[model samples]
Structure formats: C-alpha cells, structure tokens
Target: MSPPARARPLSKAAFSPTFSKLKTSIYTDSLRPSAPVSSAHFIRTLSWNAPGTLIATGAADRTLRIWNPEKTNVKNSTELRGHTGGVERVAFHPVNETELASCSSDGMVRFWDVRSKAVVGEVKVGGEPFTLAWTPDGSEIVAGRKDNNLIPISRSTLTTITEHHQPVQTNQCVFTWDGSAIFLTNGDGCVKILRYPSFEHFYTLNAHTSSCYALSISPSGGYLAIGGGDALVSLWDTQEWMCVRTLDKIEGPVKSVDFSFDGSYVVGGSDEDNKLHIAHTETGEYVYTIDTIHPAAYVAWHPCRYVLAYSAEAQGLKIRSTMDVQAPLNPSTLFSVRGLLVVITGGGTSIGLAIASALHQNGASKIYLLGRRIATLEKAVETLKSSSSAPHYVDVLINNAGVIGPRNGIELHESESISQLRGAMLKDWSGWESTMAINTQSVFGVSAAFLPLLEAENIRRHWQGSKVTGYGNARHHSASALEKIGTDADDSRLAHIITVASIASYIRRCAAGLVDNASKGAAAHIGNMLSTLLAEWGIRSNVGRPWNENNIGGLILFLVGNGGTYISGTVQVSDGGRLGVFPSMY
Candidate 1:
C-alpha cells in the first residue's frame, strides 16, 4: 500500500452553493433563569395547552414554571410550588386553558389553576409517580408509576377509579385521538395499545430494537410516532397500529418526541447527544437540529405557532424557532384546511367527532355535524362554534358516522363444528343485518346526501382563486408570520367525499401491498394497501389525498387552500398494513 491515499479535496461550488446543497435552517431560542441557584435547576418536563399560548415546565428544582412563549424574551412568568420531590411531568387540561395537571418524583399529582397560581386539586399517587395524562374529555386522569401500574383517577375527585398493570415498565403513555384506547412505550422495545375503560389488549408493536422511551400522536389521530433507545422514531398508522416508517439520524437514545402544530415535522430530543432532531413525518428525512446541550425530558409544540418548547435535564427551557419557518416554501404546510366547509356524518361521537374537532381547531371554514340524534349533533356544533374562529361554509364531508354493530357476535370455539356455525349464523342474523346497515350501507347514503355541498365548496374555491385571489382562498392564503405555510398554490381538489371504512372488507389483494408485525419475519410490504394503506396514506389515485384516516382537517385545509385542486376518484386506505399482517381474513 502506498502509505495513505491522499484524501480528495472538497470541491467548492464555483458560484451558488445554496442551490447546490440543501439549505439547513436551525431555528432555536433558549430561556434560562437569570441566575443559577442550585443543582436542582435541571428541567424535567414541558407542557402546552391546546390553545398554545401558555407553556408549563417541571424541573428537578421541584418548581413548576408557566410562561407565555409568544413573547420575545420569555421570562419565568409564574411559578407553582408544593411538590416535595423533583417535578417530573406536566399536562394541560384538554378543554380548560387555565388548568394544568402535573406529577412528580415526590409521589404526588397536582392540578394547578394558572390564573389563580394555586394547586386546585391534589392527589397522592405515590409509588414514584413519573407521568400524567388526561382523557380527551378532561373528565379523568391517568398516572403511571414505577411499579408497572397505570391508575386512572377522576379529575374532579382526584381519586383512583381503577388501575391497570402493564407487564413491562413504561416510559411514556398517551391516549388515542378519540380516547378509545391508551398507548404505552415499554421496556421491551415495543409500543402497547390497550382499549380504554374496557382495558382490552388492542395490540403490540415492536417499534425499536431497544426500550422505547417516547410516544406521540398526531393532532388529527391519523398517525402515532414512537422513539426509543435505538436512536430511531417509528411512525405508525393509528387505524391499524402498523409501523409506517422508521426515522433515523439521531445521535443517541431518543428521550422525548413531538409533532409540530401542523403535523409536518417531528421533533425528538436525544439524551446522550443532547440535541433535538427534526424530521419530515412523511418521508422520514432529516430536516434540522437544535443543539440543546442537555438531555431533554420532553418537548412541546405551540398549538397555533412555529415556536417549540423543550426542557432538558440541567437546562431550564428552550423555546426554539428558525428563520426558515418564515419562508413561503416550508414543507410542513402542505396539508392544510384553511377555509373549507366540512360536513361530518355521525359527527357527534368517536372518529367522526375527532375529525370534526381537528378541522375546527385548525381553521376549516366551517364544520356541520350530521347524525341521527339531533341533540348530539347540535351539541357538537355548539362546542365547535365556541372553539374555532368563524368561517364561511362547511366544505368537506367526512362520512365517518357508523356503528361497530351488535354488541353480541358469534365466537368460534374449537369444539364447535360446521353445523354449529350455520346455526350460530342464523341466530346472529339480526346482528349481521344491523352491522351491514350502518357500517356498510350507510356509506352510499351519507355520500349522496353531502355530495352537493362538497361540489358547491369546490366551485367556490375555483371562483376565489380565479378572481382577486383574496381571503379564504386556501393556498396563498395570507396569514400572520408564525403560522404554517401553505404549499405550491394550485387547487384541483374539488369537492372531496372522504369515506371511512375498516380493514375487515378487503377480500382480495396483491401480496406486495401489506405489512406485518415483527413476529413472522415482520416483513412490512406496501401492497396495493391490502389493508392499511388505503386508510393510512390517502388514496394516491385520481384525487390527491393524505395518509389513510387522512387527517381530515389537514386535507380539508389543503383542498380549500388551492393545495389539492382537480383531485378525485380514488379509494384511500389507512388500515396500518393490516392485510399484510394477517393475510386475507376471508
């Protein structure tokens, strides 16, 4: 060998380097105490309310500080005291902006009233309470302990209603979008999902090679992201809990994770690397990093702005944003529902209500709730009217209202034979008919009912864009500096009728489209979406769509914004590769 081969010199771009290499933007802001007081100053957790204006952080110093991140110089606005041990976690009430709930190593969970700056409710959870989460309705609270126990307590009474024993130790827990289930990251490098209230084991996902430490769900309930000791983040389809993709390039064990306000970028803080990594949720590509210097315990994104808040082990708190966010071409703004009207069937409860809420909160033009129960529909409308800004009309129609069918169904026992099966079918004939009526037949009925409204919305968008290109145009829609940017302005997305279905319907499919759990070779193949793809990644055919389950609000925003123009005639799948995992069910 001739000594060492000379290393090639880095060739300089003769002229413009910016266009040659990808431009990297690092947007970050740090907030620290004026003077360091003690070793207990390490930040442990961070939380933001649904409105995004207020932020709360817990620290080893046993202090909980609340601040307004909107300010240029974020001061430790208000501090709450009472926990004897280090503050471990904080959660804002889903509906109440003024109320916050927190837990600590001191073995206590406290709910604080921001305006009063006092602990309104306190409960002694003990057993080294490390985390806290609120049900979507904010009526109850769940706390995880070091002993592998999950205790759900009433928010009003702050007393344990029930507790569940999760086999593996838990690092984090989160409720699904509709609060139908709770997902947890365990020590076994897996994410476990259990039905809420019923406490049934929904499924388990092998997300990482090592223990998983962080978990987050997108605002629209379409996706779930998990981070772990493997230095990777796995994004999964919420509908079927199938891993969509694995995101890497992290420095060390991922300590915490979060989605940006717009669900475009995913941010995870690394423990050993002491850095915050931001990656594109769709493509799983690296975007930017924020040097945090200390291991971060949690990260929070503002509900409506570009600001991000994270707390590190020793550092106080970091409120980060970058100049790149101000650019008109930011990728995160691609899916938006700026000014589109939405009509959701069965919009009063479950998935229907969840989609309606996501759209309303994110700036849809208007959302109309249609269901059999007039009272429930009216209530939903009232709730939305009170929550979101006023918009013109309901643009998109979410045909999500349907029933799971009869409470009682046929179960197979090894002891039963074909004769028993035939008799059982007859006995359950009524259940079969009812299930088909709601879960199957209703699709046609609801779609036809809302077709006219959707068509009208499309025509309206075309008019707006062709004319002065003014307000409510969706794409190139004028906005304040901090909001998520809209995409390469064009709106062929005319009148969308997003129909929701289940994985149980796929009778045939090509082999390539399905994915599997890690057990049987765990080969995750992207078939013609045998099961989950249709619902996870929106239909890619004639009409442009997002992932299945589709994140209706974001899609509506994009369509209304001139982002999705002239798109139609496609069936989207979001079953999380269920067909791949189980093969054809029939």
Candidate 2:
C-alpha cells in the first residue's frame, strides 16, 4: 500500500504511544497468595460505564470483574461469578453504572446489579453469545451468538424480544447512535445493516476481502469502522454509506475496534502480539502503537476522556492516559466545592452559617437552609444569595441545632441533701428532653430524610443509583469524573452529612453539663452509625467537634468538597488540642 497520509500534530497530544498495564488485585498475582495462580485466563471483552467511572471485564476464567481504575488496592475489584463457561462479552448500561450485562460461552446472557453482586435477569439464547451491546437509550440489549443468532433482550423484562438468525457467522454487533439500526459483522467480510425493532436488512457493505470481525460507530454517528480477518480496518461515512478511509498496518486479523470520544482517532486491536494501533480518523495515518506482551484482543476508549482501555491475552485489563490529562489531586483544585448542591440545618447562624459563607464564596451551585425559625433561615438565604454570583445552590445540613441543659453532674452532686439533689434533677427534665430531640434525634431524622434526594442527585448526574448494602457494593466514582460540573462530566462526589456535635461527646469531665454532654454523645454516635448505614447507599457521614467557628467552616468545606469524597464515618475533632488539655477520655 502507498504511504499513509501525513499525521497531524494534534494526534501526538491526543494519546500517549506507550500503554501501561494497570495493576489490579486480579492482575497482581502476588496479592492472592492462597489461590492458585495461572496465566491462561485471558480477558475476552470489556466495557466502560456511562460515567467512565468503572470498567467491566469478562474473561476465560468464567468470571466478570468490575474495576475502578482510580483505585489500585487489593479490594478495589468485585467479581461476579455465575457464568458456567468462559465469558465472551460484557457491557454496562448506557446510563446506569450499577447495571451490567454479560454473555458467556454457556449459551446464556445474564443481567446484573453490580452493587448487589446479584443476577437481576438472565436468558438462555440456545447458542454461545460471543458479543453484547446495549442500546443508546439503555432500554434493551442485543446479544450475538457464535451460531449466527441475533437476540434482543429487554431491560425491563430480561426475556428475549425476538431472535434473528443471520446468513453468515456473526462475530460482533453494535447499535447505531439513534438506535434506529444495527451494524453486524459476519464471516463474509461484509457489514450487514439491519433496521432495528423489526430486524429487517437495510443494506450491506463489502468492507473487507475476508471475514469481518469488529464494528464501532463514531460518537457523532457520522462514521462507521469495520475490522476484518484481512488485517484491515475500514472507515465509512454513515450518511453516504461510502468508504472513507482504510487502515492496514495490522499484523493479524483485527479483533476489536473503537473510536475515541471526540471522534479524533480510532484504535484497532489485533491478534498479533503488541499490534494495537491507533490512527487519526481524518488523515487515516497511524499515530501510536501500543506494545503488549500478548495479543491485544479487545479495545475500548473511555466514553468521556482520552484514556484507552484494552485487554491483552492473559494480562487482564490495562489503561493508559495522554499527557494532556491533568491530575485530579492538584492542590489548587481539590478543595473547591463548585457546582455542588447543598442543604444545611441550623444554617441561620453560627458555624452553620459560616459554612454557608464558605460554600457561597467557593462557588457552590445551590444552598438551602433549614432551621426551626423560618425568618432566620430566610434571612440567611437572602444574605448568602446576595453575596453569591451563582443564582442556584444546594448544600448539606450542618445539623448544629442544639440546646444546653441543667448543670454538670458534679455540680448537681454538690447538693448534700437528697431532697435538694432531687429538686435540682427535676428542675429542668423538660429541657433535657428537648435537648435530645433536637441534638440527637433530629440529626438522624434529617439525614435519613435526605437519603432519597442524595441518591437522586447521583442519578441526575448520570451516575448509577446508590448501591444497596451487600457483598460487592463499593464506591464506583472514577477520579476524572469527581472533579466538578464541566463540559465533559459532573462532580462525582457522593451525598455527605456533617453533624456539628460538641467536644463534650468524648470528654468524660462532664464540664459541659449532664444532658448537654449526653445529647452530644448521642449525636456523635448517630453520625458514626450513619457512616456505616449510608455507606452502602453512597452517602458519607462524619461528626465534627467544632471548637472554633472558622475551623468548623473549613472542615465543612473539606468534607463536602471533592477532596473529601474518600472520607466517611469518622469523628473529626477540631478542638485545637482542647481534648488533650482536659482530663477526659477522648
């Protein structure tokens, strides 16, 4: 073939030529000492969730693994085991991160809730499903079997909608951007276009000289890519249905193909060792080559970023990023709470209002104040809104509403006569009851009420619903998606609760008062309880002992901001070492 077209400079910065093998617990054989290790279980297919926070991989080991690329710990992955045969393909729902689907060589396709690690649905298609794809709308999934059968399965009801047997051996299938049609690769080196729902053939393209094995549609829906056994990948204009470009540097049959998010480049996986090639779409020139120890069998680009994910034979999943990608941990960017929706209780005055001020100054999107007095809350909201440049804002409750009761236990004990002590104890029993109702009971009541809204916030941001507590549920937000609401993605921080309990919670001196200390202690424990109870639901809870107003405000900013997404279920004592100075058990 003639020399490929000249590559543009933009392609050089789009991705790095060198690919790095991501070390996961499954891939790091050293992490699992008890289990027998083997290099024979190669990855078969992989898919990235809609938010780009997770990657789901299917492998020859008959298991499906979900990975949060941001975490490298031994527990960062959750394995779903049910497939009796080797898994062939895995796909995440187009909009739901928690919902996933996988097909295996045992002639079954199973739907799963990754959080619960339970099979939600399944179907026996009568043939080994070698490929899977979810419609753009996420209402249905299509599974292509090695026996040339194409089956459509409904998301609401896991049963097969209908089965269509293709004339040629089906290798892979993908739905168009509009879900109006499907592009299916087959043994005839041709791409068959079929109208959806009805499964009627629309047209056919003579894409390669040999069996076609791969298919990918550009994000813009303007171009179609086809890979074949002839070791060539062809790009076609979807509108005109004409060949636009041909890429042929592959050393073996192309097994998989994908277009980057912006449609700037296309990558092809080959059966030849280390032959993963990335080419500029406009110029059709090879821009990068990924060297792998084994043949690259599957390739996928993140839906919203430049990061590329691929599976090498027996190597699990690998991820590589471009130099243009910025680190999420940059100090200057980490603490800002921009675009966050917040609600704060007792926010009309004191530390609650101080935190509102911090959030207002820092660019929180929306803020709502909750307090016993509507006038106080309205006044605070008016003042903060007047100061903020952004009109919309929401916030987490500070849970600072409280009341101090009677005298210290020691002082009450000073009464020499039993009658005097009894009088002192009964003097303000009502006040003690009020303190518990406000400080302790309200903390739990308010946080519990907000759980639904918090979970809804995650869904509104295009993330999956909060996971129900169970075996495999864990935090799923990707580092890149956790930054803020931007052109690319929304802030990935989960809903958080920060209760302002006093330092008296842990102080055994009883200097704060009998009911006051007791109520604060209950509030602190409530926060701790919520940390575990709400953790599975993707909500974080923390108790803050606010000794200083400014310290409490800064602490609230950190807890609700992107920097604090990883912190949950702990007591943050901002007492300036007061606990150390006091003769108390802290």
Best of the candidates, TM-score: 2
Provide TM-scores for the models.
Answer: 0.55, 0.57
Work out candidate 1's RMSD over C-alphas.
22.7
Off by over 4 Å in 1: 1-39, 72-76, 293-297, 312-315, 322-586
| Tens digits of per-residue lDDT for model 2, 396-501 | 5567777777765765757789988777566667688778899899998888777777776655543445454333222333222222346123244666788888
List the lowest-lDDT window of 10 residues for candidate 1: 1-10
lDDT assessment of candidate 2: 0.74
Residue 358 lDDT, candidate 1, scale 0-100: 80
Find the number of clashing residue pairs for candidate 2.
13
